[model samples]
Target: MGLAGALATPAHGDTKAPAVVNDARLEAAYVIMGDGFATVRIVTGAAGCPALTIDAKAQPMIVRAPHASLPLRPTASTIANSKPSVFPITVCEASLPPGAKRASVDGRPLPMPRPVIRRIVVIGDTGCRLKASENAYQACNDPEAYPFAIVAAHAAAWHPDLVIHVGDYLYRENPCAPGHAGCAGSPWGYGWDSWKADFFTPGAALLAAAPWTVTRGNHESCERAGQGWWRLLDPRAMQPRHDCNDAADDVTGNYSAPYRVSLGQGAQVVVMDLSHAGKKNIAADDPRYDEFVSTHDALARYARNATFTFATDHYPILGVTIPDGEPDKPPKAGNKAFQSTFGQVDKGLVPAGVDVLLAGHVHLWEHVDYSGNTPSQFIAGFSGTQEDAVPLPSRLPVDTSPLPGVTIRQFDAWTDGFGYMTMERTGARSWKVTVRHADGSLLRRCRIRGNHTYCEPIFG
Candidate 1:
């Protein structure tokens, strides 16, 4: 809150509260995109909540939302699935107006949203893969194998005005096989340790560099890392059934209402909670299908009013993915569930007013342009997770489509392994995007004009 946050009377003699928690361990402090404002979030090891300054005066932060700024007890679901956490975590947040000028927690500085968002880093599906389902284990200690820290450092060095993690922050779900050196000793399960290792530890630099707009991926679904998603990044007020505490309440836990984040300069992003969406199509009769319809309707309303709108969901509605286990393997396609639901809702999948679509989950970088009044889709799913060993065809068929009406006008992809993407706003209606590898090596450069994205070739 360098200064978008205005002053609020300190809650209950907050001036007496210590602005610097000299005794508590400030594990993390960063700004994340709030519902309409910016929220200053901190994870501390102390039982006592720390204090922050809105301008020159200190204000005490309450517990987590809808109640106090306090931590929730781990439900039975977590008790049975995760190990006892070594760190005592208290997740707390305080909102600062979009115009707050100065803000600090425990005397440490925190970055604030810029008056004009000019540089943005888009990342997705970032984590070390440690899944027993597929018997896949990434070398967590190897930089080349799991380069999220490097990618984040590079993004921070670029001086981004804002950061958007498309989704899927947790992946160290299952343990490393006994004596397997690749992922030996790495934390697993949905506890604080797992989340710390998976995201917070690796993404420290970028977290401090700019405020983040967090998106939830399938990995963060109620069935997976949803518990941590709610505690740390879901960008919504804490609610009961949404905590992923019981299987009985999964219908509520999985589907969250969509909201918009207005970035200055006539640009806004509609964030959707389609983490429940995956490879299988959700039939129209299913109760969850209505959630997609609601999201589509909300996006239409948002797009109709904004000059430039971006639909940021974890899954790409009209993207090109390298499908795993398919015969030839180069059978590239888009998200099936979204295609089915959005196809029926709108002919182009994306509503008429949205200009850009940002997502991750395919574990690669892709840019797909369409033939009609369709939005361009950019996938930055190459952040860290190991990708399909089966590679995509060097050239994708352009006459084809992900759905019935959205014809592919152009296609581009790269990042054999880990990487990230950046968008630099250049004009009122235009921006330039760069695709970079884990080491920040430039792979492609593109320009965006409304819904169209044109990128220079990785080789040419």
Candidate 2:
């Protein structure tokens, strides 16, 4: 299909055609990696892998660099457990030619990286749940109920410079049974079809808008959907270990390394991976804990060079909603460990320069300001999926008795629907953050100056 035909073009009013289709030739959508160099990836379905070719000079121009016909090579391992088990992916890597305008992939135009980035769309936990048992909230199958494609179109309309997806791409854990709400008889499994329906098809428009920095979520674990994550989205060169049960040995690429990307205008974004961080108490002797500390310390040092720095991971260090059945207790061990290591500047776990820490895992939206001691935490986990409906108290006490003397002066939480945040760089040291609902309604607006943030509601 052509670029325009391949993209999920939304219809008028509240209805939309199913964005994802069963294209046997091209299964999952292509991903434009935001690495230091230019890269693109595509996965083939059970029709058997075809000779992939890229004509950089084709029409509907996508990239701004000159190039020739570049053939994509299949990386190490292919997605396992696929029904046909012949699903393979191909990647195309090439250095952009100076002053180049655009390029094409299989005759479809692909988006190129921006020379200067001013706005970014942040989304996470975006996956459609298929199993009826998993849909306790009855969110599956219904387009209005699970509006990932609608959300993607809305985000694409904004035309952000790039997108930062904080992980959890594939979520078709099991097949949908007959007579489900929105996903009746939907094909379910760890295959290209599921990946397309869950991510690529719904997110096709947004994917074509700009390059992306894809994070590693627990759902992308090797045992579950790790094969898809490793094949289509991951930007790292070296392949991760394929052993489903071995967690300690599955550390490579985005899993253990911290990627630093320059966003121009004296700003930078640091992407970290804590998917392997254990849930139990992480003792001082734990090598993973040590690695986490060391990684942040280095990132803290890296943040000092940029005027504004934001870090993102799949998990959150500070959360507004408590776990189910534990309403009156403190945060979990992993959360506490994260706070102990990255929330306290006096403890040298986090540095003073890092401005904000963006995370997604709890399936809710919250903004936790720590009085400038640690990075301000913003949880945008409600991008998609069934959200946690935990209620919150009207007021939270500000406790400054802890180390570094930090306290939560203000807190904002939302569980109404799926949404994403847009960060616009207003000045070298200032940014305006607007939190909007999935249907494009304003929720709140905040301004960030130095390490401080002030927000106010936008009432109709």
Models 1 onward score TM values of 0.90, 0.79
Candidate 1 residues 30-49, lDDT tens each? 88885577888888777555
Relative to the true structure, candidate 1 reaches a TM of 0.90
Q: Rate the local accuracy (lDDT) of all candidates.
A: 0.78, 0.62
lDDT of 2 by residue, 1-460 (tens): 3322222222122133222223446543344544354455544432222222344442211111111121222211323322331234332233333245565444456666666688989888888765434443334467677777877888989988889888777666665554564666555555556667788888888888877878888777655566566556666542225323243444442255677767777788888877666344466665666668777777877787888888888877555556556877543212655655554433634576888878887787777766655567788888887776565554664442224455676677777788988889888878899888888788889887766676676742
Give model 2's TM-score versus the native structure.
0.79
lDDT of 2 at 79: 33
lDDT of 1 at 352: 91
Give model 1's clash tally: 19
Deviation in angstroms for 26 in model 1? Answer: 0.9
